[model samples]
Target: MPHFFSHNFLLLAGLCCLLPGPQNTGASDLNKKRESTQCQNFAPTITNISLFLLQKAIHWPEHTNLVFSPVSIIAAFAMLSLGTKGNTHKQILNGMGFDLMKMPETKIHKCFQHLIHTFLQPNHQLHMTIGSSLFVHKNLKVESKFKKAAMELYNSETIPINFKDIQAAKTQINKHVMKGSYGHVLKVVGDLPIDTVLALVNFISFDGVQIGEFEAERLDKLEFQLDTGKVVTVPMVKRQGKFYLLKDNTLSSWVLMQPYVGNIMAFFILPDVGKMEELIQNLSHECLNSIHKRIKTRSSNLSFPKFTISTTYDLKKVMNTLGITQIFSNRADFSKAIRDEHVKLSKAMHKAVLGVEDKQWEELDFPDLHKNLLPDGPSVEFNRSFLVILKDITFNLPFLMGKIKDPKTK
Candidate 1:
């Protein structure tokens, strides 16, 4: 079996913001609280976008695992909207679940600027990088204002490439994505169209270590039941410790919150036998907030599967489904981005990678509490399909959301 520790492991990557350290002064504390409040206010929009993608993913084949970064997609489109005008700009913002009347264009960009800056802050426990880049043809003249806004607001890079040389252009774009994602995603653009004038690329990479202990000797193969009644063997890591566990009767699922070394939490939702569809349908931003409020600390034995997953998406089609059709059509307007030429978005690509390893637990400084308390709590084995949401606890934002049908498949 291919384990998550392997070098080929590809996990979902998303935008991650660092939490501010403890402050002693009253003024600093007040600023920290304000930052937290701002993030909380902006979180619902991103979460709604993730839910829309998840609902669309249900139409995919049953065996196919789903993984994507809502934060990355939103940031990329938000950056693109900087150069867009008229209906194109409105469509992009509206499709992202933002109301322009309440939050104008300037406020929207400022919010993203704050997010990108906070996301790039130094954090030792969690290693993450997220960025967007625009690859324009060498002959094209991009407006200085658009370039300046993209750089100052979104921290995005604008690179000029000679599209006439298809292979070189592809390699150049791929290298940018590789560097931004810290080499997790090797290639994002496979081929460049002959008339490709501009390409927008977004990449995010996230690495977090476990906060609990998992003995290597305890790693064993266990039976994993699929949704279609098929059983498969998978590597399972077991540990008993204190965690936030919730049994939601409304959704017919058990929610387990696992904390990482940093201010990151992974929520594992296991539906009862065949209630995956019900859980998926009932899942929403409001529902998740409710779950967060109801979850309580308890002792439990957690048996989680070790796995890695990666996904690449054609964002043009994905955005189209969300009613963002002008950017890909001939009527597209990017006058703010390019000067004296009508340039529409030729290609939009996004890739994310994620890997979970049991070895990460070895680095944690947890005490041996499982030995004395293993028999006192319920055993929660993830022996079937489940949903995973990786959230940044400080901002109350879920960056990556995935459905794990089979660990072996990835």
Candidate 2:
């Protein structure tokens, strides 16, 4: 059955992208005037946090697929940190892969601003949206300093709501997040907890077409073995083209990379039998860099399963695990960001969705054997009518995954 494109699929399944037509104008160009030079050096810090968060999330059951944008999460925290002071500020920055004492806070905020403007704003190619909101009860007073920073720097919309009306507050926040993410994240605030005075929510949604799409005729049903040894049939796509490939004998894995329309790169890591667990266990920032440096581009037939996955994170727990405790505690100092002394961070929520597919460029066509000629030793000569069966390369089970986003214009 052909998958239908709809918002529900985007929110629940996190796959099956709706390719934007030539006239799609939803993306805005408000930030195009400013040069994004600051984000060049700043991107690595955000990327570091993404890797850290992914490593922590990898503990999920091996059988389950995972997807989240560290850029969205970091943008949310950066917006929150604009109002923090003393240890609270330092702790948040530290967890974000920065040295608060050495790095000026203003510089950090400016870099975040650059990142938001660079990625969130509309472009001719990538379809993406990132936004944040601060919900506070009407009774509490918010500091003008923090409010101005949030609006000007993060492009976030700060709304004052009555948190006392729990149901109303939830509905309002959910609606705002849905619009912010363009319907990718359905619910942001589930239930307002008792004594909750303030909530910070951030959302990111992205849908991009493959640079080369796989042919619908080549889609085949194949078996996928889960980590638990359960084999399931799934739709797999095939393409024979030149792509960046790396065989890491040291890690006993082969890495294949595919390009998306924008600057996104999907990496598929297939580990040798029984080595999947070990490869995942040893996955780290340094190891990834090492593997990236050794990759070589080559022509080969690639077959991969077409699947979709979505994930929601309770960022408070993830932050605490990363040594960001003061902000979520009573001791948190928000004197600079809020007028009310009693208000502290009560909830932090983030949701992300990603979709991937294959594209077949003209280069992917089966080579003409006679025109290209062949080696002499025991090699069979081929003509236009010669049929050559290719080996099947499948990604069924025990794999590691990573995505790199580098946005560019068409």
Most accurate candidate by TM-score: 1
lDDT of 1 by residue, 17-90 (tens): 22122222122246655766665767787787888888787654343677778877787888888888999988
Deviation in angstroms for 34 in model 1?
2.6
Model 2 misplaced stretches (Cα beyond 4 Å): 1-39, 58-63, 209-217, 281-297, 357-410
Between which residue pairs do clashes occur in model 2? 212-359, 212-360, 213-358, 213-359, 213-360, 214-358, 214-359
Query: In candidate 2, how many clashes are counted?
Result: 7
For each candidate, give its TM-score against the true structure: 0.85, 0.73
User: What would the TM-score be for candidate 1 when compared with the true structure?
Assistant: 0.85
lDDT (C-alpha) at residue 296 in model 1: 88
State the weakest 10-residue window (summed lDDT) of model 1. Answer: 2-11
lDDT of each: 0.70, 0.53
